[model samples]
Target: MSILTIHPKDEAQETALKTILDGFAVRYEIEPDETEYLMSSKANEIALDKSIKQAEEGDVVKIALDDLWK
Candidate 1:
């Protein structure tokens, strides 16, 4: 199966597309807004950079695989 992302210009267009999909019984999921998603992704990148810096500076604890869930 493949996934398709559609960016409708407005609510009317979105509604129209959804109606057609509903009529055809096509399963679909509404995703987070693009702008909001991008903002969140940026925040994650920043956090990852900080974590990498800490690891380089020996600021992380080493946990054994078996102790990870303890």
Candidate 2:
């Protein structure tokens, strides 16, 4: 079993692909659209990289659970 990510070029293609998969009874899941968050631009990736670097450098600030709502 392997995971595959398919980015259909348009809605028509997406519908056609899903129909074919349904006809074959292949188990698959349609992930929630993340175009806005994940692929809208490169900002998300840059932010993620920055966070990773901060974590690696131990530059994160820790807060207690009790202080979270404060």
Q: State the C-alpha lDDT per candidate.
A: 0.88, 0.86
lDDT of 2 at 45: 75
lDDT of residue 53 for candidate 1: 100
Which candidate number maximizes TM-score? 2
In candidate 1, what are the lDDT values of residues 5-28, reduced to their tens digit? 898999999999999999999999
Error of 2 at 43 (Å): 1.2
Global fold similarity of model 1 (TM-score): 0.47
The residue pairs in collision within model 2 are none
Q: Estimate each model's TM-score.
A: 0.47, 0.49
**Which lDDT tens digits does candidate 2 get at residues 1-70?**
8888899999999999999999999888887686456645688878877888999999999999999999
- Model 2: worst 10 consecutive residues (lDDT sum): 32-41
> Residue 45: error of model 1 in Å?
19
Show where candidate 1 strays beyond 4 Å: 34-70
